[model samples]
Target: MSEAARHELPDLAAMAAFGARLAERLKVGDVIALEGGLGAGKTTLARGIIAALGYTSEVPSPTFTIIETYDAPPVRLPIVHADFYRLNDPAEVEEIGLDDYREGAAMIAEWPDHAGGFSHEAACLSILLETAKTGRIAIARGGGDWLGRMP
Candidate 1:
C-alpha cells in the first residue's frame, strides 16, 4: 500500500474540481472505488467525474439502478458507474454480469466493499470520503500505477 493523499473539499465545487482532476487521469480498465457512508458525497463525486469526462446530461445515483454506463463521444471513454449498496454478497457481481459490463470500460464503483473491492488491481484508486464540519475529507489510496498519478 502507498501513502494516501488527503484532499479538503470545502464545498460542492471543490469536490467537483477534485473529481475533474481525477477524470483527467482516467483510462480504460481503471477502477475507482469510492468508499463512504450515506450522504458522504460519493455520488456527487462520481457525477463530477462523469461530467468532466464530457457528459453534459444529469448523472443520476445508481442506488436503485445498480449500474449506469457512459460511452465515448458524450464522454472521452467508456465508464461504468455502479452502486453496490444493495448487494448481499460479492458473488452477486457475477450474477449481474459486472465483468461483461467492464469488458472495455473503466468503472466508478460506489459501496465497492459490497462487491469485494478493486483495491487489489494495479489501476484501482480507492477514495474514502468522510463528512466534515465544513464539507468533506477525501483520503485517496491508489495502486502502483496510480501512485504518482493521483488527482
Candidate 2:
C-alpha cells in the first residue's frame, strides 16, 4: 500500500475509532499483535475494541495475568487478550497453550516479542505510538489480509 493511503490516528480517541472500525471487520481465528512502548496506549486501544463489541465490564491489562478471555454476546468465539511482557522465554508461551488460543478465537496480544515466532504467517498488526509536543502519533502497519481491513 502507498504511504499516503496509510491510516494515521492522531490521539487516543482516533485510535479508539480505528479500533472500533477494526472490530467491525474481525473474524474468528484472527490474530492481532500489538507492538508499542510502555504507556503507548495499547491497552486503551484494546479497551475500545472490547467495548465496541458490547462488553461492559472493566477491561484490565493482561500484564500480570498474561491473558484474559472475554466472551462478548452475539459472537460465537471468545476474544483472547494477552500480554507477554513478563515472559522470559518463548517456551513459556507453550505452557499457556497459546496454540490452543490460536484456533477459533480472535487474539489481541501486547508485547508480542515474548511469543517469538508464533505470529509468523499470522495477520500481524503493528501500532507504533510516538509522543510530540502537541499530542501523540499512532501509526499502523499490517501484513497479509489485514492490509485491506485496517483503518
Candidate 3:
C-alpha cells in the first residue's frame, strides 16, 4: 500500500471542499477509485469534482447505467463517472467498454474492485470513505503519479 492521507469531512460542504481541492490538480487519464459502504459520500465527492470543473448540470449517480461521460469545453477535461457496484465479475467491465470510455478522460469509479481495481494504474488514486459519528472521513492512497499530489 502507498502512504495514505486522511481528510475529515464534517459535512457535505467539507467533502465538496475536498473535492474542489482535488480538482485543482486533476488531469486527463487520472483514475479515482472510490471504496466505501453504503451512503459513504462517494457520489457526493465525485459531484464536487465535477462541479468544480465547471459542470453546471445535474450529476446523476451511475448506479444503473454503469457509466456517465462528461465532455470537454464546458469543463477543462473529459470525465467519466462509473458505478461498478452492480457488477458480479470483473469480466463485466470489458462488456461495458470501460477502456474505450477511459481513453483521454479522467475516471471516477465507484466500487472499482468490481472492475478489477485501479491500484495498478500509474495515475490511479484510491479513496476509502467511512462514516463517522459527526460526518465522514476519507483516506486517500495514491499510485506513483499521485503520491506527491494527494491532498
Judged by lDDT, which candidate is best?
1
Which digits, one per residue and each the tens of the lDDT, describe model 1 over residues 42-150?
9999999999999999998899999999989889999999999999999999999999999999999999999999999998999999999899999999998797788
Residue 72 error, candidate 3, Å:
0.5
- Select the stronger candidate by TM-score from 1 and 3: 1
lDDT of candidate 2 at residue 114, scale 0 to 100 = 78
Top-scoring candidate (TM-score): 1
What does candidate 2's lDDT look like per residue over 37-106, in tens digits? 8877778888888877767778899989999888756433578989999999988998999878767778
Name the lDDT value of residue 121 in candidate 1.
95
Where does candidate 2 stray beyond 4 Å?
1-7, 74-77, 117-119
The deviation in Å at residue 47 for candidate 3 is 0.5
Error of 2 at 75 (Å): 5.5
* TM-score of each model, in listed order: 0.98, 0.84, 0.97
Residue 18 accuracy (lDDT) in model 3: 90
What TM-score does candidate 3 reach? 0.97
lDDT of candidates 1 onward, in order: 0.95, 0.73, 0.91
> Which window of ten consecutive residues has the lowest lDDT sum in model 3?
142-151
Clash-forming residue pairs, model 2: none
